[model samples]
Target: MIASYEMKHQVPYYECDATGHQTLAMLFRLLILASEDHSDALGVGTAKIKEYDGGWVIINYAGDVDRLPRENETVTIKTYVEAYNRFFVVRTFEVYDADGKQLVKVKGMFAFMNLTTRKVASIPEPLIVPYQSEESRRLPKVARPQLMANDLAWERLDYRVRFFDIDLNNHVNNAVYFDWLLDPLGGEFLRHHRLVNLKMKYDHEVRAGEKVDSQFIKIEEKNQIITHHQIQCQGKIAAEAEFEWKLV
Candidate 1:
């Protein structure tokens, strides 16, 4: 097993919403910071990755935020290698109370890219060696995303695409998907239950001119929630997603 890397942080004022809990955006920031610390620990920091003519970028992710850290509460984040396949490496992260009960788990899919060419490349030998040397790591083993088996039902909420939603990519950034997925649930769902986990699949690209529809479904029997979101053009699924949320 790879040695666990730990990072300590206090929830910052800007990170919390008006209700004094960490916001979804802030949760992403915490993962990014923890990822950086993990890279730095491995001697494969960003600079070194770039020096080798490649860098890693997130292609996909599944995260479960169990509890929101209150403002000023110090928490610890621990991360480790879970497992990897030829094209992608999977890593896991857990956020915990200072006393160590896990509050969140994040699993990421990463691809090595030749930054100059903006294309996927083989993970460099130096980088792969150390990570692979450790005991094999695998993803959290969450259930597979359910493709719409039939004419599934969904509650729709139409949202306007704004300039703020557009990122440097000149399109709605991938991270923005979480907001669209979560928003239809309203504030109460977000506030009361921790997000146990989620899965997002991007079937089509979302552009600025398009208005998107957010859809939601609750599976009470499984104590799980799933959403089938799409940006329709002439009535076709533009992007499809099935998120799994377990109540804390």
Candidate 2:
């Protein structure tokens, strides 16, 4: 029985960037691994998801990193179920330093989807039972993106379409957008506060050869920062989004 699994991990050198800190993309990957571990513990790993003719697909995710894990540092990821809606489940992650202090917190919304049909499906009862926890509480109210905000404006950020960014979906991978957004801020912000939250709204498809603009709106009262990405052809908002970043 994988009761309350724990694993120690040393940050790999390759996962670090020029600043000698773990890359945002790599951090996301680590969290994915932790989630898989949780599935294994509950005996509902990916194979079981497939067995039910259903699979888990990330619909939306918001996370905040408080500090960047340096090279060779051992960090622990503790995760648990926060809540579940009819079509979506909210999972949370807490990353800790070797000393056990919290470093990063991630919350994601996942949908049970029919792989073949590529559509949302009702979560199976057996699947949900094991994942549920008596201590699991309702997730905190998150500030969602506003499709239209008067204070928000789009700033064009041009990215050359790269062959590698295209995933099996034939579109830019969702995680790649984080690189685009976080890279602009440089490693300073990432190195400072651990990411406590990140909200991403994929408004439209990003294809090769298309230039895009990322927009931002500051909502300090809520300790939240919002951003948008748009595909610009002749300077029009083809796609738009707002993201909330909460400080840990």
Candidate 3:
């Protein structure tokens, strides 16, 4: 059996931002879809997870984008299980253009959680064995995003958890967090810049009817702009992210 899986996709207009290129959030969504496809091929996908009453949750994700796919462009996404421990699995992804030039590289860490308790659970052997991934004492890790200081003058926006934002898991979908994080930057900034690198840590989940406050602080370094974001629910942090953007 092949250790990796790949899929071809055409960049859709709805997935692109004002810059006419795929948004960072859409890239993340695509990576997730690819992972789901891989898991389904291995016989351990959504249906199996439901049978186990467990779901996979991303603990952290980090990626670097060399180029963003433009609207209507055809691209390929390749993904594989990099490594796994007793509690967490590490997966990696690469996006390539039609010419085979890589556009993005991504790494994600995920843990299985029991739906009832919402706590980490041991991965089933049957599920783990199918991936044929390496078992390691130390799996790859992404740095946790730091909290934005209260003293910093940060821009903030509030969003209600809409029905559309909820996924099958019944919580705000992880991909929606990217919109909450970047939309506060406004169209002007997004039009003039492109996301180059991003790292995010999900600390808490936002449920429907909850109001989430998205805040961020921008730091200019050399030719790049780095932004730190914090999403809070009821004054408690739900997620944190760090983004690096380059001038267009």
Candidate 4:
């Protein structure tokens, strides 16, 4: 059995931004696709989830990017199940350029939620045993993203959840949250700065037609710009993320 799954992907034009490099959000999308493909190989993908009326939901994600692949560049994404518990699983990802230079490394925590209950469910042994993944009694954890100060002056943008933002699980796709979090930064910042690292936490799910408020505050450190973002829906925090960027 393969210990890890890997696939090659060409960075497409639409996935790049004005800077001609893959956007931070698109990197996440690619990682997600790689993860899905890996799960399918392990026989625990969408079809398997349906067998239990459950779906995988990301709880936390943290990653560091040495460089972002440019348009048309072929990159390889490799993924493996690092560990898991009854309710949560940890997965790791590595992205490499065609020359085999590593570009990014990421870790994510996810939980299987019962569709009807909308609550975490124990992963079935059939699903867990196939991958020969390490099992632990405790949930795999990732560092929580820094919270933005409520009193700080924040730039806010409002958006209505669109159909395209919804995924098969019927909630706003996790990748879309990065868009909502960063778009408020505007073109100038996005064009001149490149994301170096990020940590994100999903607090609640946003449904289609719901209005969301994206708020952020930027803080400049010696060589990096750290932006704290919050997305709120229906008076509750839906998601939060911290992004670290460097001048390109």
TM-score of each: 0.75, 0.73, 0.96, 0.94
**Which parts of model 4 are misplaced by more than 4 Å?**
137-141
Please estimate how well model 2 matches the true structure, expressed as its whole-model Cα lDDT: 0.66
lDDT of 3 by residue, 116-235 (tens): 898999987778788888888988776667666889998999999999999877899999999999999999998888788889999999999999999999999777689999999988
The residue-by-residue lDDT of candidate 2 on 170-201, one tens digit each, is 77766676676655444565454344445554
Compute the lDDT of residue 34 as modeled in candidate 1.
Answer: 81
| Model 1: worst 10 consecutive residues (lDDT sum) | 135-144
Instruction: Order candidates by TM-score, high to low.
Output: 3, 4, 1, 2
Looking at candidate 2, the ten consecutive residues that score lowest on lDDT are: 134-143
Query: Mind sharing the TM-score for model 4?
Result: 0.94
lDDT-superior candidate, 1 or 4: 4
Candidate achieving higher lDDT, 1 or 3: 3
Q: For candidate 2, give the lDDT of residue 22.
A: 85
Better of 2 and 3 by TM-score: 3
Which sections of candidate 2 miss by over 4 Å? 1-5, 134-142, 145-153, 166-172, 184-197, 203-248
* C-alpha lDDT of all candidate models, in order: 0.69, 0.66, 0.90, 0.88
Task: Identify the leading candidate in terms of lDDT.
Answer: 3
Better of 2 and 4 by TM-score: 4
lDDT of 1 at 93: 76
| Cα lDDT tens digits for candidate 1, 140-207 | 44333456644567767887788888876577766666677777878776666565566655555577
